[model samples]
Target chain A: MGKYRPGRRALTGATIVAAASLGLAACSSSGSDDSPSDGASAAGGSDVELRLAWWGSDSRHSATQEVIDAFEEANSGITVVGEFSDWGGYWDKLATATAGGNAPDVIQMDQLYLASYAEREVLSNLADYSALDMSHLGDSVLGMGQVDGAQYAMPISTTSFTLLVNQDVLDELGLTLPDTDAWTWDELGEFASSVTEASSGDVVGIGPMNNEYSLQLWARQHGEALFTDGNVSISEDGLASYFQLALDWAQSGAGAPADQYSEQAALTLDQSDFATGKQAMSFTQSTQIAAYTTASNGANLVPVKIPTEDANATPYAYLKPGMYWSLSSQSKHPEEAAQLIDFLVNDPAATSIIGTERGLPANPDTVEQLSGNLSPEETKAVEYTETLDPILGDAPEIVPNGASDTDPLIQRYLLEVMFEQSSPADAAASFISELQSSIDAA
Target chain B: MSLKELNALAANRSARRRSGGKADTRDNRAALGFLSPWMLGIVGITLGPLLYSLYLSFTNYNLLQSPSWVGLDNYERMFGDERLHQALKVTFTYVIVSVPLQLAVALGLALALDRGMRGLAFYRSAFYLPSLLGGSVAIAVLWRLVFGASGLFNVILGLIGIESSQSWISNPDTALWTIILLHVWTFGSPMVIFLAGLRQIPRAYYEAAATDGANVWWRFRHITMPLLTPIVFFNVVLAIINSFSNFTQAYVVSGGTGGPADSTLFYTLYLYQEGFGNFRMGYAAAMAWLLVLIIGAVTAINFWLSKRWVHYDD
Candidate 1:
């Protein structure tokens, strides 16, 4: 018995040591899979492979992959790999990758984050890449990507903040569409209230308008910028008016109750009040009109100019980049990256594959070429954008660092005012102070 | 009781001890070999990151830039940050309210299920299902749908003529409560533990109390309560620790913003937002360490207080 005990112990010890080593080996094997290719790509060679990353829906993924395939075919020596994720997880993954010094060669950029990444030197300066073409892109649109006179990103497409109206709901209520071209904010509010009164609450006239983008447009209509000179520049009075209009609309029975309004504010695009056929009008960017239309099951969704305080004054509507494509500063093959970006923007065959998924193409020639194949909704977006071309104001300055962090504060303050938890004046003051402090901290 | 028996026991113990010396070394080697996987994981994955985070807490380490030492700046910044305070308040309120309510439900259900009855296994498994799914993202999404403005809860309230028009999950005043209820609904694990504790109590004790003329309430108070204290204490400690770190439900329900006026911002969720959303990893590390300290202090207090009420069979 004693001899067997010692033998069993020896066997167990040997088995356990073998198992431990195997476990560690399993972990190391999984980690090393990506390092070889990653190391090879970082060592820049004539035969270069690039990692391109973006965030979008399944359709966008397939189309972008097609574009990548075309780019790889055109430049036989360069291979491009696609890394994509949904918008929700994209930023977190990008931040981790960038921190690890393994960022993709090309990244999809957003205006809200352009300054932050550019200032950190995580993005490469596009002006250094002579292979990239920019003459076809408008200066105003391209300027959105510039920080301190260096172009760090190039705009791929543009979207304008517009009012989306569910015309089916309006028609069901026997109400004619209000003339948005000359409508004032008060006029819009009254028309909305009338629709709600006519429908007897089966439908709300409008959903809440408390988002930062809508507030920015509201401030812009009053000749105020959301941010200027690296600080929040919207006046307290301007903010108060902005909140007060939504409050008045809520009180007048044009908008959802404060509780439902807040709920709708937090909903996804497909679940919004207008998309669910519970509201006649909602504010959205032109790029969102298609999603709203699809959600409403082919309802007659129309986009119109946002109402202004004075229609004769400088137009408040501005063309904003849907997103930008920028090269990473860590890329080993910046020239190859530049060639890919140029191909995406200038090659008609590639743009055709991209279609209107990113938004209307930023290039006028690409827009014209893609116009012939647009879906009805896409065509409507194109026509809507062109109509505003004659009167659109200059785009606001690039959003400052830490600006995205202010979104929750804005939502909180908006709800506080709407629910009468705080006065509009007080909410405005608090928002301004908090926003400035956040920006200052950044 | 007898000196002879006592001496025999001592001799047996010494004989075993002498032999154990040699076997002990061999046993330890085998045991450590078996434990190597977990030890390696702890050292490489857990402890490595934990110590790195402690070092990072003293620096200004935004993800994109190299960390620069800032001494206590990250900790100092917490004093003036209202959002940090709000997150703390929300987390404490949630933990304070949730842990007790969840244990009560767990203990109550456990007592009821402890009786030897037909289909007991079926009922046990059925009740345990929710706890299995409680921390999942799908459950969090279901929670949002259940408490949405035009959701099942409000729909039922309307049917009952309660006249509630508010979205329970989005309203600042009640959003946290919905999440607390989600925590309470997942009381199955503690219930199962309490069941085991209840079964450990001798059935003869209850019969003796009955013969001594104790009523149902009296029997429960005298026989059950004292005997179940250890399990209750175990459940309370675990529930408090789990509640303090609640994140997935709040993150999914709040859409990762801890929104509707930040009413549902758990501490860990706020830490994630700072680390990932704002890219302030140093500040997030500081917050993470603060949470560890807070949990440790609370647990120490619990252990100290347990002596007054907790009872052991021996």
Candidate 2:
């Protein structure tokens, strides 16, 4: 202990990098001492402990646990250990676990990170697991979980992005939505103005929609993509105006003031401007309509298609998975994990327990079966997506490898533009360049 | 008597040497046994990861895949990365502004407490409370709520007929200042140290100066200031280093986005965002090592400056 051996220390230091990486590679080889146990469980009908992880609220957790209990009861040879966290902590924990070679068997995946994980080969090919029944899920829905034309994950539920209008807010202000079915950004702005003026500035019309999804829709409405063919294709000027929309609203008193809007960015869903009746409309995933309704004390929120300025553009809206069930490539029990996923998606027992909690069912038959069981808001959310199916846009290629950073990247520039720290053109240029570099680096 | 003591010490040194020193050998083994737990932690837990991260700095190591060597690419990117520069600017401003202000508040409080006042212990503990919690996520969250729009600060301003709805923590121009204020609020640790240093100053110095018709200001300037120089220097160096590495307060206040246009992006938080948020572990590792170098250089500068102002009895 007292002796100094710099050479030995350096040698050990070098081996650590090798050894640490070797540990990850070794996880796949199944050569570690614990592999025998993991392998035996996978290879045989021996009782297997399949660890499932997800992120959700308390209601979702209780429902998921209830379903897990039913699944365990049905499958005698398997016991599922369900671990859950809030949304923010879930990804970090998953990444850390995957890196440490201790990832769960089944993971609730988000579309934003699906490609990132799949491209990195952390997720198993869904095709390899034959027990999972996904035939009822159409190609468009399945494509959302695909990378390089191969399914790497399964969509748990389908959700579409929509602009939600608070009918109650409009009713209180003694105003009406102006033919919202096929509105433009100008119409959106005008409607917001009418609400603000009608309410004497007590209730702003819309909260900030300068986020990634809003920008994506805006780009698609112009027949482009912020991410095109694995690159950011939107020009700086186009990007500028997208950000400038929120700033215009902020200045025109159609949206919350700059400070208030930015502060509201940090708030939880229930405390958001729309939820608090401070904004007449806001953008959200259709799946969140139920959550918003609950948060706003049943505001009678209605989902409206995203607005477009150009008459010639294609449908800019697409259904995204509420979350996906992905099998970890490092899982010792891939078959059992697939079985669980199939059960969760297909079994009436599981569906009845989970009833639109994860979102409306991803499969057509399951949706039909659960239509009667859905909560009032869930039925509306499901019905809204169903009505828009014919007009939904072509699914985007699974987002690029580094596209998971879209939210924070877009958010930073959104704030910069709104605060006038940088002109919209400059902010757009910076954002595009930054996003491009990240994509290229990835 | 001194000659005998010197002989005894020499004989003891000889006995402690490695010539048939069985007792000393046993003592060494016992010493090693005592240190084994800590030694294992230092090597396996600390050094292993430390060296791994150093190696990772030179590689493209995303957590999803094994790292491949990228040489100086990550390090080279730092010079061109504008966001890194902003993070550096924020960190430098925070350390520069907050440390001096915090030390001043701590010193003032320490001096105030130095007087033999009623319930000195109570005041000391009360002042020290914030230091214990200042870096905690809970207090940082509370800080966010307190400075948010329509928060207590704005509500208080309204009471005085000065209406404001500005969210101090969300505005980029004022965001870093709120964090600086959070840093300054944790003056207790330095205050306690200053209190101890104040006690070390002999009361006789003040008495002697007073007898010579020195006023309170003169006594404080001549007797107290010189004696407190070492403590002041210590606090300055520590505060600078601590504030430079500050993360929790900014992280919590910014909601982990470092936002309102990246104003509150501490270097550590930026590194975390790069490493975990974007999966740019290699770049993040390089950033972390750079932070170490930056903190090292700053501390060295502080030590160098200390030579000019530090007063020691020797």
| Backbone clash count, each prediction separately | 0, 0
Give lDDT tens digits, candidate 2, residues A127-201.
888899888888878877888988998988877788899999999888988886667888898889889999998
Candidate 2 residue pairs in clash (backbone atoms < 3 Å) = none
For each candidate, the DockQ is 0.26, 0.26
The residue-level lDDT of candidate 2 at B207 comes to: 89
Query: Compared with the true structure, what per-residue lDDT tens digits does model 1 show for residues A84-152?
Result: 986657887788788878889999998877888888889999989999999998788888889888999
Per-candidate TM equals 0.89, 0.91
Report the CAPRI category for model 2: acceptable
Error of 1 at A356 (Å): 3.3
Task: List pairs with backbone clashes in candidate 1.
Answer: none
Choose the strongest candidate by TM-score: 2
lDDT of 1: 0.82
Task: Tell me how far candidate 1 lies from the true structure as C-alpha RMSD in angstroms.
Answer: 6.4
RMSD of each: 6.4, 6.8
